[model samples]
Target chain A: MEKKTRVLLFKPGLDGHWRGIMTVSKALSEAGMETIFFGFKTVEGVVEAAIQEDVDVIGFSVHSGAHLEWARELVRELEEKGARGDFLLLVGGVFPEQDHEELREIGIDGVFGPGTVTAEIVRFIEENLGRKVSG
Target chain B: MEEMEEIRRGLEEWREAKKGWPERREEFRTDAGIPVKDLYTPLDMEGIDYLGDIGFPGQPPYTRGVYPTMYRGRYWTIRMFSGHGTPEETNDRWRLLYEEGETGFSAAVDSLTFSGVDPDQEVHGAAHEVGKEGVPLYSIRGVEALVENLPIDRMSVALVVEPMTSAAVTSMYFNVAKERGLRKEQLAGTTQNDILTMTIGYIPWGSLKPADLLKLACDLIEYCTAMGEAPRWNPINFTTYNYREGGIDAVQEIGMGLANAVAHIEELLRRGWKIDDFVHRLAFHLSAHRDFFEEIAKYRAARKLWYRLMKERYKPENPDAYRFRFHVQTAGSSLTAQQPMVNIIRTAYQALEAVLGGTQSLHTNSYDEAICLPSEESVRLAVRTQELIQEETGVANVVDPLAGSYYVEALTRELEERIWDYFMRIEEMGGVVEALNTGWLFNEMSKAFNKRRRDQECGAERVIGVNCYVMEEEEPTPPFRTNPRAAEIEKERLRALRAERDNRRVAALLDRLRGVCERRENVLPVVSELTAAGATLGEITGVYREVWGIWQLPFVA
Candidate 1:
């Protein structure tokens, strides 16, 4: 039996925009990935959960324009736990195109902004994880 | 009747003649999936009586306009919803908009404020979001700074907060007004105390139960309008605009709004209030979306339906209760991030729809909003978009200018019936509160979200920059970043407030609030005093959460 790629997604902090994250979760699940959507969690909590769940990818969405702050916090949390290189970290939400490089520099593997296609996200996950997800 | 018969015969010949000409698509439909015909004539409006169905403005069945003169008497207030970084920065932005001819002000609060958490709270990473989404009004000091040196006494202000913190936040503003030597009777503003906004639209953290939210919402209406505390203030605005931005169409938008309004009305009436007490001050905030004619017809249908609902059901003796006055905002969901300049043209056309629909107020979205908060230049352009419609365009000169158009009138009648049917479906499911508890409203929102995603992906709904006319290698628009020290500044403000205010007094008032919550009485009077005594929103909402308990949403991913 093929081991399904596990992905953990959440919303960091108190930002309440849920549609984008929920859509991505459903898309990844339909794409044959085991998605665990922890609705709202702290970066530290998400990192601990991802490590415990043995997820291949950890993703979070932010629409509160604090994307840089959140991205940095998540990376710091992962580094502090010695799990920075363990999972593919992804950040997606309503942020500026100019901030994509800064987000990537903050140790995020995937950065999806506004008008992102769900298929593009699935492809990014599959390609980066070194496995073809059969949907 | 003879004219209708002749037009019916003419429509049959025209339909046959049009069969030879190739149409643009196999089918034509409005954004709401209502089938559209190639042409409409008097036959389409045969049963719609002008006097009974489409009466003149300021009369029953206000299909034309809410007021008799409409924009001819005065232009719709250009009330922009804006806030960022800090209350001081937001006040500066308000001054800029006012200088640029904005008539009203709306405060958009940050996530911490929205969720009733202060920046200094121990909640996870709460400081990161302080003053990020909007201005942080945690205490009365922030509220005072937000309206400092502004003519709030004359111009109306809107506090875009939900029921969770509406009582506390609104009271903060009211207290600010009072200290500035203004009476509550002379104050005019709106509180976006819509229950569905938190439950469905944005889904704030630690939200109260649907029934408890209803109690909080009705508490405000009972305080301001029914109790005559702030007689001129609009205590609650049923903001369907927030919900519509989640991808619902025109029919679902108005349908949900009507059902939501009914929930509040029933709650207030149950609390021993007359129909005329609060219904007249019940305003709406609707969206102006892509469908030009359909959006126009939607405003008309909404006015008529509100009139019909009031006349047939509540029958408030106050004539103003039947008027469905609304503020229209150009659809934020319709704007695309790619080729952002095109959003300007899109906003212009939607603004025109609102003007033709006879909106009482309007807010045009900035072109760069799809990406980040609007820059000063971009927001200025957004204000100019509405200014162009009022100044350059002659559309607002006449009231409901398209009132007699065959397609518009027919579509209005069609939409009125469809909206009523959808509203009844909600009513059948035990109204808005029950539907919310059963997760039925969330299901509707999720369904709409998926459908819109699918439609856009498959090119069924062609967004100019996203799907069609794609632009590659475009220069990124310069993003407007909020103040980096906003969190630190807001935390300092809270710290200072705590040191200065009489802690004993605040604690005693909080105890009173807990008792009020236990008795399920109105929380306004005590909350007003608490805000004056420098109590934070987190403290006030904390009491409610402790007493009522937080709601666990029946949400599934």
Candidate 2:
């Protein structure tokens, strides 16, 4: 039997556009993943929830262009706490294509912008977790 | 018999060959929650009567339009929605848009100011908000700053405000006009005093108690109705569009909107106000989404429904009260941040749809809406989209061009039935207020939203820039960038305005305003007094908070 992948999804700013986050949460839950939604969190708030929840991966669903700096800042926080390389970080929303390379360098393993398939997001996380189990 | 059997066997083989070639069938539904049929024939509209359901344009129960020549005589007003940073910035943009052929102004205030506060307040900066959402207004001065270069007397302004603090905003605009030596009779504009829906969605922001909100809304309606003829106050805005953006299908949008209209009418009738006195100023703010045919039908059905409800149910004597006048704003959610230019095309299509649907006025979304505040270039393009439809398309030559078409009439009737079902369902649940309180509407929206997302993931629906026709190498930088100093600039402006004004006058007016709010007197006159006295928005709102208290949002957010 395959173990369920626990994913903590959150919004990092005061922005209240929750349609994207809510829809994704529904998708992950339907796909049999234990999706914990920490609705509208600050960077520090998200970091604290990650530790408290002890999840397999963290995904930031942001639309307000502050995702680039936020992603970089969260990665640094994870590294300092020795949580880096242990869990995967995923980013989604209306991110421009150019920011993809920079986000990856900051320890982000995946980038899902407009037109992103929820199944693709689920598959990526599941396969990476599967690799860990097999290795 | 042998030859016939041989032919049947060959046909069976042909049928088997086609078995797995096509994708799964998809369901099509309007945003109003109406399930759309694949085809509509005369059979579908068998019960509908041409003279009764959809009569000539400008007639009672106007399914076609509120006017005889709708677009033929005058095209729908190109009402551009523009507000950001400071009043100065917003005002400058308004001038630019007008120069680019925009026919009217639709103001978008910052969230802080919209909630009735000064830009320099503590809540403004912590939200990382500032001019990110809209222009920050403080008092009559901010209103003055917004219309400095623009012609106030010449233009029609639509203040997108809820009833809670609309009196104060409208009073400030009136005060600005008074200063400009323009008569109240000369002011041509609309203020969205739709109080019912303010509490219907987003539990955090609406008037907490229905009775109190209704009282304030009634006061505005009464005040505007008495102002005599220049038609300054647009007291009621049936915001079906807001719900549409939040994922409610079209039928629910119309149904809930009509339910809200019913709520307003019931309140007014209970208060002994004549129906004709208050209904004329009522206007609708509709969303023009991507669905071309369905959208047109939705508008047609809305007009007919409103007209019939007013005439048959209320029996309002005035012909004007029975007409459904509305403004259309293109859907922002349909626009993608990726391949932002494609939004221009999307906006143009929606704009054309609005005109064909017989909108009184229209606001086409800027291409940059998915990302940030629209730059001047993008704003101009949005305005031009409306102008192009008016000048080039020749679509404006008739009113409701698709009215008599069998497909359109059938679709319109189907849409009417679906919306009526929603209205009935909500009424059974103890009206829109109770439905909103219990999260029934939100649940419906979430369910539909999930299905739509599933379709996108399963490749049932195609969003060109989002799910299909994506470009991997294209890196087009957006033209607009929000100034981080917007908060600071607004703060300085607020401080200076406060320092320069008469301190005693501000204090006296605010104290008087607090007294009136607590005494159950109509707060409009008091708010107007405070605005004229040069009191800040924060001061006015603080007084109301002391009297009425802030709403505690019901949701878990």
Model number with the top DockQ: 1
Candidate 2 segments exceeding 4 Å error: A1-15, A31-135, B1-45, B124-127, B194-216, B226-231, B545-557
Error of 1 at B252 (Å): 0.7
The collision pairs in model 2 are A115-B466, B31-B249, B31-B250, B32-B249, B32-B250, B32-B251, B33-B249, B33-B250
| lDDT, candidate 2, B1-557, per-residue tens | 57656665765676688677764456666554456764554555667888888889999668899998887788778888778777888887888777777778988876556566565565412235556567766678789889897888888998876666678888889889989898767888888766544554422222335556666776677677734533566766777787777666678778888887777777767777778778888788998997888899999988988877776788877788888899999998788877889999999999888888989999899887776668788887887787787778788887788977877888888887778787888878977656656767667667777777776666666788667887863656554665668778877877787899899987887888878888877777778778888887667767766787655433432
Across B1-557, the per-residue lDDT of candidate 1 in tens digits comes to: 78877888888888888878998899999999999988887777779899998989878789998899999999999999999999999999999999999999999999988999989988978999988889999999999999988988899999999999999999998899889888989999999999998988898888889999999999999999999999999999999998999888999999999999999999999999999888999999999999999999999999999998998899999989989989999999999889999999999999999999999999999999999989999999999999888888888787888988999999999999999999999999999999999899998998898889989999999999888999794689988999999999999999999999999999999999999999999999999999999999999999999999999888743
Best lDDT among the predictions, by candidate number: 1
- For model 2, what is the error of residue B282's alpha carbon versus the real structure, in angstroms, after optimal superposition? 0.9
The TM-scores of all predictions, comma-separated, are: 0.98, 0.85
List iRMS for all predictions.
0.9, 4.3
Cα lDDT of candidate 2 equals 0.75
Alpha-carbon error at B65 in model 1, in Å? 0.7
User: Model 1 chain A: which ten-residue window has the lowest total lDDT?
Assistant: A126-135
lDDT of 1 at A20: 93
